[model samples]
Target: MNITFLDSSTLHHKNDLDLSPLKQFGDLTLYETSSIEEIATRIADAEIVITNKAVLNKELIEGAKNLKLILSAATGVNQIDLEAAKAHDITVCNVAGYSTPSVAQHAFTFLLNFATSIPKLDSEKQQWPQSPIFTRLDYPAFDLQGKTLGIIGLGAIGKEVAKIAQAFGMNVQALNSSASSAPSGEIPRVNLEALLKTSDVISLHCPLTEETKHLINRESLSMMKSTAFLINTGRGPLINEPDLAEALDKGIIAGAGLDVLSVEPPAEDNPLIHSQHPNLFITPHTAWATIEARHRLLDGLVENIKNYLAGCPSNQVV
Candidate 1:
């Protein structure tokens, strides 16, 4: 098989990950990155295509005359044209649950930073050395104990977050996306309206869909506690960026710790980019890039291809 990795830079490092497993499959061509115009030409004759964040659009998919399989190097498949793949009878596979722990931990990393004002304390290191008093209560810090944690989506990552919140003595609640039935007894499911109005802390873990896009907007922000904090480790479009910026500026909610944004490498005019809001913390969409998780993703990709070659496919998007 002649396989082409359209954008391997996402999985590449300076002599870090072992590539023997991927190379053994076929004559592999790995491009660190690719241009949209170049993608059609580079993958023209490939039997298999691998992509991390490259857009395998309808035109590109149609141009790959020899294409058979497409293995997405990550969980999200929005970058690929699934309808085109289905029409062409090409099998598409993605790795899932590979970044559960990494993402779950990152949510708290941001949450704790806001909850404890770690950044401000570090910035004022000189104050600690001074002996004006035994303690410097300069910020509004609070304990996680007895606080409410409302999770928007209760999937694997969400469940793990709920467990950690409980360990911190927090009262956990969740909003069922499907609303099919209640989840396990530990975290009682609540409606979006109730979760918005009641929880002291709200974290988003849902996917980006028409209904879920801008899930947190002016109206929803209005329902939150004046001092509550918001955390997001899921899809960026789940919240409207402009509304969030306005919310933070006017103190609509307390603050927001975001690991994802509606736009990556946002433009200069992006509302959240230049805001000096002390409460807004934005990480460059790296909540899922831990070393352990990346390796799991690599291993899972090889396994997905192995299954496809054996005449069976797993993790097919329904």
Candidate 2:
């Protein structure tokens, strides 16, 4: 079997990952990165194609004459055209639950940074010695205890984040997208309006869909408390960048911490990138790139292919 990895560099950053396990399957061809134009020609004669964040549209999928299986290196499959893969009878599978812990921890990393004002404290450390008191109290900090955390999605990652929030003496709640039945549990589901109005901090973990795209726009931002903070570790399109930038500028909400953007390698003129808000923190979509998480991702990919060869594919998306 011929296996081709279209964008190994996305996962094997700094040559840290070992790709030897993939050798057992067949002749594997690994490309550190593949451009949009290079994908079709590179996978033309391969039986299996693996990609992370590569745009495999209908044209590219149909062009690969020998392609049998498509493996998404990450959990999300938005980059691949599922309708095309299904029409051509190509099997598509993705790795899931591999980055739950890493992403959950990162969400809190942002919340804690905001609550404790860590960056401001570090920047003013030089002035600490001049104070005659035991310690300088120049920056205002808030305790996470007693604060309410509203989560948009209650999947594995959201559940983990809820556990951490409870450990900090904070109340946790999730948005009830489907109101068919009233939820009754530790993390009770509430309507979006209620969540936005009551939560002191909001973290988004839901997948992006037609209904969820730009879910947090001007109207939603206006509903939030003036002192509330926002955190996003899921898909970026969930929030409207222009609206968010304007919100921060006008103090519509307290601040925002984002790990993902509407577009990766965002344009230089992106509103969020140029926002003058001091409370905004943006990480380069690295919440899921921890060393341990990457290893688990790689292991999951290998297991997916192995199962496919055994005639029982795991995590099949199409």
Candidate 3:
């Protein structure tokens, strides 16, 4: 069987992560990246295709006559056309929960940065040599203990984050719109308005949908405590970039730490990119790309393929 990975670079560069295990399945063709113009041609004769961020729309799916299976190397399959794949009898599978630990850890990395004023302290390290006292209190750090953490989503990563927060003696709450299956737990559910007003730190783990798009906007920011901090390791579009930049500028909120943006590799003109607010922290969507997580994602894809070939077809979304 012919197998192709359209965007292998999303998982690795410079042969850092192994893809050789896939060689046992079929003839594998790897592309560092594929353009919209090149997708159809590359998958023309492949039976199985794996993509991380490469888009596979209706037209491309219809044209690839030999395409039998599609494996989304990451959890989100938003780039794949589910309806088209189903109509064409192409089995679609996506890896999930593989990056839970990595993402949850990264979210706290941001939270701790704000809580401990690590960035500010590091920036002011040069002034330490001339200090009149033993230690510089230029930026005082706050304790996470007793501070409420309002989580916008209560999925695997969100749950893990809650566990960590509790370990730090934080009180945890989830948004009312969070996962419906949020079971009996230490975390209580609160409405958006309440979460906004009460939380000392708000961390977003929600998916991006019409209801959640721009969920954090002018009105919501206005409701939040002036000292509250926002952390988003989920989807970027969940918060309005311009609104967030304005909030940071006006001190409507204390700060924001973001791992994803509405647009990946955000345009040079993105408001948040240019905000330059000392409190604004942005990581290039790497919250879920740890070496360990990437390996789990790759392993999940191989297992899905192995199952499909065995006629079991695990993790099939369609």
Candidate 4:
């Protein structure tokens, strides 16, 4: 029952990860590799493979004949070859809901910054006395109270965002990709078109799936009010980056706050990187890396591994 964690750097580098439970299971080997070519040889004798960024494709899965399970430290398993793993009878598990609070807080941070023009004001203070603009109260900030906040996902994180929005005196509404059997109190469910047209601030917290990919695109952007703000704390591909850039250029929306991009470590030529728009704020994909959230993720990951060892896999994926 040997277990190896490939790309454990994402967790081990964080101060919060508790490796005690993982050590109790079996021999735990960890590595940080930039090359996928090295995976087969590295995982040859491992029965369980835990990966955060390492790609477990068909070739690597085939080569690791002893591998029984793959426990992804993150929620998304897009990097893994699910079909090949299923063919090899390898169980795959992913930790979910571990970063609900962390992500939700980030979404609100963006919303508040957009609503109040916090960054703009902070920058103004630096050049205040030297410039003539310091004498005038030219920059105005808006309050979030009585504003409509639209959420694209109604999952745990979305629900948390809604609760916090309500605490801020905002009117919270949501649009679920599919209809839910359970009722959402206070937060009324609305259609995409309605939410886009009416919301003062819109936030995304959905998973990236076939139907949800580029859910916010050119056509949808056109429907939003010019003063509305868009926030994405979800998957990068969920919104078309180019379309968002055009929207910002044309003033289709007031601004955008994105924690995810179409690509991780976005290229130098990325439109969002050099956009002249002062309203656009882009953060390196770190909405889930808060100290508290990483601890929860580690705890859940250990539980997943422990459950798998007990022959009753938790968080099992097809």
Candidate 4 per-residue lDDT over residues 60-178, each given as its tens digit: 99999899999998998988999999999999999998999999999999988877777887887766777765353655778899999999987999999999999999998888545
**Per-residue lDDT over 1-318 for candidate 2, one digit per residue giving the tens place of the 0 to 100 score:** 899999999998778989889989999999988999899899999999999988899999999988889999999898899999999999999999999999999999999999999987898888888999987677689999999999998999999999999999999888996533444666788899999999999999999999999999999999999999999999999999999999999999999999999989899989999887878999999999999999999999999999999999999999
Candidate 3, after superposition: displacement of residue 191 in Å? 0.7
Rank by TM-score, highest first.
3, 2, 1, 4
Off by over 4 Å in 1: 177-184
- TM-score for model 4? 0.93
Tens digits of lDDT, candidate 3, 52-151: 9999999999999999999999888999999999999999999989999999999999999998888888887888999999998878889999999999
**TM-scores, one per candidate:** 0.95, 0.96, 0.97, 0.93
> lDDT per prediction?
0.88, 0.93, 0.93, 0.87
Error of 3 at 30 (Å): 0.6
Task: Give the C-alpha lDDT of model 2.
Answer: 0.93
Q: Is candidate 3 or candidate 4 better by lDDT?
A: 3
Cα misplacement distance, residue 128 of candidate 4 (Å) = 3.4
Instruction: Tell how far residue 157 is off in model 4, in angstroms.
Output: 0.8
The C-alpha stretches of model 2 lying farther than 4 A from their native spots are 178-184
Per-residue lDDT of candidate 1, residues 122-147 (tens digit): 88888887858887788768899999
